[model samples]
Target: MTETIIPGTYIDVRAEGLISAGRIATGVLGIVGTASNGPVGQPVTLALPSQARTRFGLADDPRNPTDGANPLTLVRAVELAYANGASTVVAVRVAGTGKTSASYTLRNDSGQQIAALTTRVPGSWGNAVEVSLQDSEEDCLVERENVESPFNGVRYAPVVPSPRTRVRVVRGATGQAEGFDVVYRRLQSEEQVRPTAAGRFFLDATPVEAGVPAARISVRKPGGVLVDYTGDAIVYETGVPAAGTVRIDPASGELTFAAEEVPAAGAQVTATYGVGHALPTTGQVLLTTWSGDLDFADGEAPVQGDTVEVTYLLDRDSCVQVTLTNAGTVERFVGPDADFLSARINAASQLVSAEPDDLLGNQRPVNDEGLMGSGSNVHGADGANAGRDEYAAGLAALENQLVNIVVLAGQHATTHGDVLAAHLALTANSEHERIGVIGAAGSSVEDINAHGMADGRVVVVAPGIRYPDGITLASGHTAAAVAGLVASVSPQTSLTNKPLNIPDVDQDFNRGQQAQLIGGNVLTIVRKGGFRVLRGVTSEGEGMPYSAIPTRRIVDYARYGVRSAADPYIGRLNNVRVRDALKSSLDGFLTRMVDEEALTGYELDVFADRSQEIRGEVSVVMTLQPTFSIEFVLVTMFLR
Candidate 1:
């Protein structure tokens, strides 16, 4: 028998209409028919219905019965139908008695029922044979070069192409057909591969209709580990050959890969880099103890001539005391470098006469210069020139004697006589009596006596003389000369006409006045003395004999004579010195006393010291007390 083979189906089948047309009569007909023959040269066309024929070994309708329906062949048929672009196919059914019918149901690869059919029915002249074939491609070998099976990394394989088979191609190595072009073309025409700017790959290169990028293929390892691609181009080496899965999407920069536990926790990471800028700073200046003549360095120089006050912590309880030594040395006339003798004289005069009392007293008498007189003398010759020359001579003699008297008075008062007495007598004689002579020329007793006798006789002989002879003679004569003259002049008496009765009344009056004046002047002098006397006496006379004088007689005398002196010189001097000394001493004493007492508020005390001393120059000490005994209280009440 001749047979036909179909690609992707059955291999061979019997020819149609080859069976006898008549049925055998039991046994006789069966044997006779077996020997009977038809025309030997005629081709007998076998007749069969289309429903009974199977195309590609499949029934026209899948509902038709075949040899129990081969499920494997059916499944193969569905796969080939899909691959061959057929919508549907039919399976052929065979009946009993060697007859067949084609009524198989049609179906697509999805098993959905379909209507496409190839059916046939055999004639009843004799029994017939039928065959079913699937409309599927044969299971033939399809060889490919470098065709990668999606499941494994095999390089070459002869595969039966199926609808579900996923394949890819690379370069071919041998005669096996390369499917790379076909795969590439299919991929290009249907789905494309693209690279994204993020260096990722995507299956569909075309942009989405909504203007979004194509979707990418991504794959993650266990625990969601992925492979990331930074925008920069990077090369990675596989130290060992690896056949692992990776997912990537070129259009979206999405990549996924598995990492082998990450070496340690944070491996395969990136670090960000940057730098920081420093801020500008203003300069500063530093100083040291001895930076030169200036307090700071030259770069930090101070303003010109600026005064800088610095403080030091001293062990002492108070600040150092500063005193001006010999401040009086600046005096224009009697300064430090002046002639010592001259300075001494001037100082003495200052001590005696510069008192507030003396300066404020009555004016000196007018002299020939038309100025107040200092009681210095003018002279002329006297004796042996009576009337015509005697007046001139006697006046000269009186002037000469007057000079001696002043000299005697100064010398006796400063040296031999009491200073108080000399001062008073000189004051009285000069201010009141108006003695004009200050020094004498004659030294001999006889010359002085002659001078005095001539002047004294003139006073008695010419009582009408405008200037008295006695005053003139005594004014200038030296004390020695006067004493000598007084001694030489004697009362020459023969039986002495009873001693002349000298009245004690006038003597007493004069003596009392002299004493009063001396006492008053002494008080004035003591009071006017400066701190020099006080400090000097205090320091030097610590155990001396006369230290009490300043506190006693001197103070009493000043207080008593404050109103008694008619001239008010003593009173003025007393008031000024007492006031000044009292203020100073009191200030010091009270400050200390108050500080010690620790009392508060406005309390006050006044004090004075009155004690006698025979020798010391200081005659008084005085003080005033503070109102507040507490320093803080005083500071708050008055100082503030």
Candidate 2:
């Protein structure tokens, strides 16, 4: 409704007619079981039959240790589920406790660990993963030059690094050098100043550091000693000093000499300070704590052709590949650097996740180490040892998925009825309508009757399925096969007399036993003509109203469709007109179902009373008659 206070004519276009139902899934199946690999308690959708081996490990993996007796339950179940026409499957790997992934450590040439590798998914299959290391081919080059000097012996300044580690000092002028006895090493940041004062007391320099000790400050005046002296006799006097004493004021950069012994005007005074490390005149080469230079103790030129070798870390561009192999499945990760290898492998490799340690200097692994470990086992990693908790948790993972059918692979409902009851309750509670397929307790009629489950959401199958070996019988997997079979067809298609592509049924049931199994509400499969279904009935007995599998499935499908179709109309105008449009949408859906033969007939009405409309409620009342499967035929023929 639009507000039209002063409007001439307001046209309101209702979009209720445009509301339509969305596509719904009818054949998705959820299966939970134990596997040798794959993440536990997470749903993984599998489409290819070969994905069973790659994701969950091969059933016949020789490293399974007890493959003769125990088998990987998930892989076989998935393989058989796909074998029985299940195109889409949501698989969950449930496991017992104590499950751990196999680990491998990569080391450099010095046996220092550089990277730690673990299986991508936790399981025993990761123990078969292998990794190898190789050295890089790139070499470290040298001679990025530092400092250059000459043997002038005029006190050239303490050497500071000038992009060269070695100071090249040639014999420019072969002369005697000063400070021959004192072995001085000129470090970094040393400045040499030759002051020509022109006048008597003032030096023409700017901002000399105030009051530094004479040791760091080397003032080589005429006939002045350059040894380490601790006395302040040269700097204490004011203006002028007594005879044979010199007074210097660093703030003014002026020197006051003794009045009687004043030097000639414009005398030369060499003041070298800020030696930093306090050494002699040289270029910045031989680094003592990243500072100063080469040997100038004797003022000798450094020997020519004497190369000082400096080392650095090189970028090893060698080929390094890590191979993760388990159950004949191999994933190789190739990179030159450890960090690169780790990033690539962790992002791409499905086998293992890697943690690379880029140590100080960004070092690379240099050694060749191979065959990290063989196949080891984790809890529930083998064929056996799955309990109810793991199964329940795995089923919980699939609760939010759009699965129409489900099966506890390799688990029997006769003993695990609680788990099956939970499965059935999910169907009854959630918006998603689903049914579970379970195998009978045994092939015996008494066993089938004693295994009483009164829920129509549960379908039971008898006699189990025979393995390809034609010897061993997996009774629990029979339910998985039936679930797949149910998922392969539409909800209206009955499972009766359908030919299954399995090798064979575990046991053959006679007509009497088949009748008893059907009456006991168990879906029975026999080898009448290439292993066909005998009945499509739920666990509820034949006398029950919802016992027929097609009846329950059709009802579930209709409920799902109606909910899907009408849910779009929520919060819309709950008046007679929109309610009728909603009714038409639902009616169209049901008519399509009836045309498709999913229902024999359906009576539907969408209505909202004045009180309901006031409460913003539009209710739908439906009475659907589902099409039933034909189970029996009788003919009394006279003499023809």
Candidate 3:
């Protein structure tokens, strides 16, 4: 009997001299032997089946067994089977016992030996089926649900193997579908997906226009609530309206408006335009009055009644001349020149004249004829015409002609000399004439003493006579030496040969001869005869002496005292001490007097220079004597 074994098993045995063991194996091997020998003359000519053919019978040959066959031989038989269009050979079993051993060549279905098999009893075999691991087709749309809790309110999609689909997620929800569709079909078909994150996916969206927004924008307040009614326009809000038209400037992001006229308060008024536009208020029109008061607002409509009252004081010195124009609908007028002084109601009326009563009240009129009665000494017997008719008429004519006549009197005397002469002429002639005489005080006194010997027509008046100590004559005799001298002398009296009983006349005479007289002449004589002489009688008896005897030393001294009293005896002196003391004292007094007089005299000269109405040379001459007079008659007639 023969026993069959499965394929794919390896068996080993010691092939000793054991005929029975061989015989039993030969029965099983008879099938293998006959199948192996039928195809070839070799000991085992049958084709070996594959492991798969041994387990599951071959579809082409079912009787063949794969056990106890060489795997290399089976591999060759499989190659031949494949070439012959057969799948595989059938299984052929092998059986053996004890010390007997049998060997079978394993082959593939093509009859090529692939493995060797040796077996005794107690060996096992089985079939092996080949299987291939292949990659499965993937669907890109497949997605796993995300179950993890999201952070905050944002919901993140679950991670996938590839970025094939755009997954949408609710802000805070998880797992539940948000109804957002994903176009995964395109990803799966094209096999392409953007590698950017989900949040940044919008970066790949279509680009928008230069200034336009790709998405709708909503502006809200701080609370995230929308404000209502505001339009899309970029508006600028300010407390005051702009003065003129508003325009946008593209270059600078600032609002601009037209500039208005300057205001009266000198305020810096500004105008505003829309946002992102510059202020264009710079070249605006300014409306102002002649006096320069103005006000303006930009961007607002101007009305006929929208006027700014400008208060201005016209400065005529300014080069720009402004004509007063009545811009108001009603006519207006102004004063004196019609434009400056008239009211609106009196537009066509002429400006009224300024009456004398308007300014001067009921005073005397300034008319030429009316002025005749206002002067001193009018004409006619009545007081109204106090002998000034012809005079007044002549004066009026002279004044009307504005003639500047400089009258030169008969003589150029600064005192009352020429004036006294003129007065005498007028008195003698008794005619009505206008005359002015000017002369020095010295000349006036001289004239008075000469012509006015009996009458007291000339009066001396000192303007600013001062003393050595700067005391004015008005301060009385105690204050000034000149004032004291004036108080001692009688008014209008002759000062020549006036008895001045100097107690020290002898001493003075002696000193006067010792020094050469500096200011005036000195006379000295020697008397030779000596006698007692009565008034116009010479005595020879006891009542009188024999004859008059004259002394050898006789002196007479006098001085004009022009600038100084010591001038006469300043150089000649027996005793230098007495001479120097007297000279110094006298010189000091003379210097003070000269300074005061010179200053006052200079002031008087200035006054005379300014007196244009008074013609002729005016001078003020001073003398040491209190009384002053002129000896003109003595010079003219008595000079022989």
lDDT of 1 at 513: 35
The TM-score measured for candidate 2 stands at: 0.67
**Model 1 Cα lDDT, one tens digit per residue, 3-59:** 455555454442221211121110000000000011111212111212112221222
* Range of the 10 consecutive residues with the lowest summed lDDT in candidate 1: 26-35
Model 1 gets an lDDT of 0.21
- List lDDT for all candidates, in order: 0.21, 0.65, 0.21
Leading candidate by lDDT: 2
RMSD of each: 75.2, 17.7, 74.5
Report backbone clashes per prediction: 67, 12, 102
- The order by descending lDDT is 2, 3, 1
Worst 10 residues of 3 by lDDT: 549-558
Per-residue lDDT of model 2, residues 158-264, tens digit only: 22223332333333244322222222222212344344445444444433433344323334435653422124545632475666556656556565656555554
| Winner on lDDT (2 vs 3) | 2
Better of 1 and 3 by TM-score: 3
